[model samples]
Target: MTEAAQKQQSEESEKRERSPGGKFMLVLLTGFLLAIPLFASWLLIYDRQSQSEQAEQSIVTGWGGQQVFSGPKIVLPYKAKVQGSVEQDGKTVTRTEIVMQNLYLSPEAMTFDSDIKTEVKSRSIYEVVIYNSNVTGLATFKLPDDFARSGIDPATIDFARAEIRFGLSDARGLAANNMLSVDGQPLVLQPGRGLGETGNRGFFAWLDATDLADGTITVKYDVKFRGTESLTMVPSAGQTNWSVTSQWPHPSFTGGFLPKNEVTEAGFTAKYAITNLALGSALTSTQASQQVYPQSNNRPYTSFDSSGEPSSVTINLIQPVDLYDQVSRATKYGFLFIGFTFVAFLLFDLIGGVRISSVQYILVGVALILFFVLLLAFAEIIGFALAYITASLATIGLITAYAASVLSTWRRASMIGGLLASLYAVIYILLSLEAYSLLIGSLLIFAALAGVMFVTRRLDWTRTLQKRPSS
Candidate 1:
C-alpha cells in the first residue's frame, strides 16, 4: 500500500477504538496523565503557603513576638557560711567563707487585669496578628519566721537589697515597662535575671522590706507591652487570679491550665483562678536555682518559646480561616473533579450517539485540574469563598463550551455543563462540612455508580463500537 493508504488505515483503526470498555481504558489513561498537573497544582499551593508563613514571620520580627510572662516573686538575700577544707599552710585545713545567698518568696496573694488591643497587619498578600497588652496588677507578700531553718539567722537576712522579679518570654515586649510602685514607694525597673529559671526575660526592682518584717509588703504595677500571636502567664503566688480580655474575635486557649472562658463575635474574656495548691509546688524556695516551671521548656531565658506548654496558661490569637489550608484541601479533591468529568464524557459518548476523542477527554481533564491553580491564585487576593466561585465558574465555562463541539449537540453539552456545575457545588459543600465530607463523598460515588449501572443495564456489551451509529 502507499504511505497515505497506510495512514488512512491507521486512522480508521484508531476511530474504531470506542464504546464502554475502550472509553473506560482511555479515561483511566487520561486520568493518569492528568495527575501530573493536579500534583503540580498541589505543590504550588504548598509553596505559596510557605511563602505566606515566611511573610508573616518577617512581620512578627519587627513587632514583638509571642510573650510569656511570670511572677511577682521576691528575692531576699542573706549571708551564709560555707566551710571547705583548704591547703592554706602546705596542709589541709578547714576554711570558713561567708557567701550571700538568695531566697525566692512567692506572693501570698496576686491578681492581674490584662487588656489586649488587637490589630491586623498585612504584608504582600499575607496577614499577621499583633497586639498591645496592658497589664495592671498587685501582689501581697508576707515573711514567715522560719528563716533559721535554711541555716540563715533572721538578723542575717538582708531586707534592704531585696528584689522583686518577673519573667517574660521576650524582653523586647517590654515597651512601656519602666517604673512601678511597691507599697506606694515608686521604684525603677531594671532588666535582668536575678535568680534562677524564673529570671528569664523579665524585669525586677529593688525594695526594702525591713519595715515590713512584722507586716505585709505590697506591690502594684501598671505596664504595657507588645506581642504577636500568643501570650502566656505563670501563676507565681500562693493565690493568683488572672483576668484577660481581648478584642480579637478568634482566640484559642491552650497550655497546662485552661481558663473559665467566654467567647463572642466582638471578642473574648478569659479568667483564671489559680493557687499554689493547684500549682503542685510550694510557694517559696531557699536559694531557688531550680526551674520554676520545670515542664515549661519554652520560656526564653533558656532561649525557647512555644505556643503552649504544660506548666503555664497560654492564649492564642488566631485567624478564623487559613486560606492556604482551604486551598490545599480543595486540591485534594482534584482527582474527583477530573474523574467525574471524564465519566460524564464517557457515558455520553457511549449512548448519546456522539463521538468523543481522547484529545477532548484530555482537554476537559486539564481544565478540571487547572481549577485548583486558579483557586489558589485568586484565594490569596480575594479570599477562599469568592475565589472558589471565580475559579469554578471560569473552569466550568471553558469545559462546557469545549464539550458542545465534542458531544455534537447543545442538549448533551448542557448536561455536561450541569454536571460540572453540580460537581463543583458538591465539592464546595464537602469542603464546608469537613466532618461529613467522607460520608457525603462516598454516597455521591455510590449514586454515580448506580446511575451508570441503570443507564447501561440493557446495553449489549458483547457488541463493539462498529454496531452503534452516530445517530
Candidate 2:
C-alpha cells in the first residue's frame, strides 16, 4: 500500500475504537429511546392515581364530605331603624326604614363527647376512609347583659323571635335519629345557617316563650352522623371542652388546638379543653352591637374575614400507607434503575468482550420498565410491599436469565443478578424511609459515580474495538 493510504487507513481504524466515555455516549443515545416508554409508564401511573382519587371523592359525595360544627349560640332577632332618602310626590324626603337584625350570644359553656367508628369502604380497587360519629353535646347560653343597652331599644328586641343556632359544615350528614332539646323542650330544627356572616353553615331551631328561662338557655343534643375523612369543631363558647374517641388506628389531629391524645393499634382517644381566653376577642364579633344578621337578609350581617369564624379543632382519619403513593414514588426512580443497569451491561460489553446490540439494549430497557407496570398492577391487589417483592423477583429473574444468554456465562449473569437485587433492595428501603430518602439517594449516586470513575481509570480502548486482521 502507498504511505498516504496506509496512514489514512490507520486513522480510520482508531476512530472505530471507542473510548469508555464514547461508549457511554452510544449507550446514552440508545437509552434516549427508553424515554418514550418511561414517559408512558409515568403517565399510566398518574392516570391510575387520578382514578383512585376520583373514586374516593365519588364515595365521599354519596356519603358526606368532611364535617365541621359551630353551634348552640342564641340568636336574638330584633328590628332596627335606619334613615334613608325616599321620593314622595316628586320630592326627596327622609324616612325611617325598619330593618331586621340579630344579636348573637355565645354559649357560656359547651362540651362535645364523641365516639367515632371508622371503616374502610372500597369502590373497585380504591379504598376510602369513612366514619360514623355519635356526638353528644351540652351547652348553656345566657344573653350578654348589655344587649339592651347597646344603643338599641329594648322594646324593639323581640325575645319571642329568638333562635338557637347550631353550625354544621354539611347538614346532610345529620342522621335521622338525631335529637336536640332546649330547656327540657324538644326543638324542631329549621334548615338555615344559624350563625350570621361567614360562620353560617348549620341548622337552627326557634325557641318558645319559656325556653330561655331567666335569659339563659340550655341545649342538649345527641347526633349520629356519617362523614368521610375528617371532623372538626368550633369553640364558639366561653369555655369549650371536646373529647373524641375513634376505632381507627391512624388519627391526624390538626387545627388551632392540640388535644391530649392517646393512640394505639386499636384506636385513639383525644381531649381538648379551650377557654375563650385562648380564643381571643374575635370570637365575640359584633357582641358590642345588637345588629348582627343582615342589612336586609341579602348581605352578610357584617364584613367578615377568616377571623369571623371560630378557629376549629380537626381530626383526620388517614391510612398508614397509600399504595398509589408508593407506586408513584417508585416510578420516579425509574431512570435510576435504567441508568445503573445499562452501566452494568455497558461494562460487560466494553471490557468483558461481550457483544450487546442496541436492539438488545432496547429489549432489556423494555423489561426494566415493565417492572413498574407489574408493580402498580399487583400493588392494587396485594398492597405495596408484597407486590414490590413479587415484581422485583420477576424482573430480576427475567434480566438475569437474559444476561446469562448475552454475556455467555452463568458467573457473569450472577453478577448482573446481584446488582439488580441490590438496586431493588435500596429502592425499597428508600421508599420506606421517606424522610431520609434524599440523603440516601444522594449518597448512592455519589458512590456509583466514584465506582464508575475508578473502574475506568486504567481501561485501555484498543481491546474494545475489533478491526479486521491485516492481510
Candidate 3:
C-alpha cells in the first residue's frame, strides 16, 4: 500500500474503533446506575439506624440528675362522674353513670441556690382534658393511699406549699381509647421525677361535667407554690430554653396500681424566687393509662380483665414517631430522580445512537450519585428545600459543562442542563406532594419515555453507530 494510503487507513481505523471496551463499561455503568433506586429503597426500608438516632435525640428530655423541685404538702378532695349510653345494632339499651371521690395527699420538695435571693419561690400549673374536651376536677394533689396505709404519719411531711385550686367534672360514654389532655395539651411521659420522690410525683388537671351537653372542657389548675426549684434546671450551653420531652411505653397503659393510662400526664412548672428563673416547664407529655373494667356484681371500682379476675397490667411508652420513616420520605423523590435519569440516558443511546462519550457519561453519573449526599447534608443544616436546590444546582452545573464539552455544542449542553433542571424540579414537586407523588411520578416517567421514543423513531441506529457525519 502507498504510504499516504496506509496513514489515511490508520486514521480511519482510529476513528471507527468505537471501543467495544467502552460499550462494555457503559453497560456496567448503566446496570449500576439502574440499581441505585433499588438500593435506596432497601436502605430506606431496612437500614434506618439513622432514624433511631434522630428519634432518641429529638424526643428525650431530662439528662443529668437534677431535682428541680419538691412542693409543700397539699390535701385534695375530688369527685367525678362518668356517663354514657351504648347502642348496638340500632338499639340504645345501656345508659350508665359512675361517680367517685378522690382523696389525695402529697409531700413535695424543691431545691434552690441563688445569690439574688436567699429563698426560691415556684408556682405549679395543672391542666386537664377528656374525650377531646376538658373535664374539671380537684386541683390539689394529695398523698397516695399507699403512704397512709404504710403507717407513715402525715405530720412528718414538711410544708412549703402555696394556694391550691379545685375542680369537678361529669364525663359521659367514656371508653378505653378516649383521648385525654392536660393543661390543653397532649401527654408525653419521660423518665424523671416530676414532683415527689416516687414515680408518682406528677399532677393532673381535668374538667367538670354533669352531662354530655357541656362537651369536654379544659381548666387551668394553678397552685401558687413557693419553694426552691433552682436545682431542677441548671444552665446549659447550646440547649433550648424551654425543654420538650416524650416517651412511649411498650404496652401503653400502666395497670391501676401506678400512673394509669387514663391520666394522660402529670407536669409541674417551677420558678425561682430570687432570679425569677422559670424552668422544667412541660410543653407536652403523654402516656397510656389502663381502663377500669367492673366485673358483674363485684366491687364497683375494682379493675378486672376479660377473665374477670384481678388482671395484671403491662405498660409501655407511646413513642409514636419513627425518625427513619420521616427521613426516608424526604429522600424518596431523590431516588426517583436518579432512576428516571438513568432510564432517559438508556433511551437516548438505544434510539438516537447519538452516543455520549465515556467521560461525559461518567460526569453525569457522578452528578446523579452526589445528589443524595448533598440532600442529606444540606437537609441537616438548612432544611429540605435549600438542600435540594444546592444539590440540584451542583449536579446541573457538572452535567451541563460535561455535555457542552463532549457533545461539542453549547446548545446541546444547555438543552441537557434545562432538561435535568426540569427533572429535578419535578422530583422536588413530587417530594412535596406526599400522598399523590407516586401516581404523578409514574405518569411523568411514562411521558418522558414516550417523548424519547417519538423523537428517535426515524434514526438509523447502525449508521449512527458507525463512522458517519454528525447529523
CA lDDT scores, all candidates in order: 0.80, 0.79, 0.40
Q: Which is the better candidate, 1 or 3, if ranked by TM-score?
A: 1
Tens digit per residue, CA lDDT, model 1, 1-471: 999999999899767655577667877998999889889989998898888888988988857888877877787777777788988669999988777666778888999999999999988888999999998999999875564465557687788988888877677777864558888999988887633344356788888888656788889988788999888886767788999999888999987678999999999999999877676656666652233224233232211224433367789999999988999998988888988888788777777767777888887887888899899889989989999999989998888788778877777778888998999999999999999999999999999889888988887664567534554
Backbone clashes in each candidate structure, one number apiece? 0, 1, 56
Candidate 3 per-residue C-alpha lDDT over 1-471 given as tens digits, one digit per residue, 9 for 90 to 100: 999999999887765545434454565576466456546654744444455344443332222111222222222222234567788899986666543322222212122221111121112211111111112221122233344463333343222221121211111111123223333554322222222221233333332222111222232222221111112222211111221122211113333222212222332222222111122222111121112322221111212345553322222222333333444665555555555555455544554345655555555665776666666655555655776788789988887887666555677668778888998887767766778988988899789768866866775444424543433
RMSD values, in order shown: 4.6, 4.7, 17.9
| Local error of candidate 2 at residue 93 (angstroms) | 6.8
Question: How does each model score on TM-score?
Answer: 0.84, 0.86, 0.43
Q: Rank the candidates by lDDT, best first.
A: 1, 2, 3
Worst 10 residues of 3 by lDDT: 125-134
Q: Which stretches of candidate 1 lie over 4 Å from their true place?
A: 1-11, 78-101, 143-157, 194-199, 211-214, 286-308, 458-463, 467-469
lDDT of 1: 0.80
Cα error, candidate 2, residue 456 (Å)? 0.1
Return model 1's CA RMSD, one decimal: 4.6
Candidates ranked by TM-score, best first? 2, 1, 3
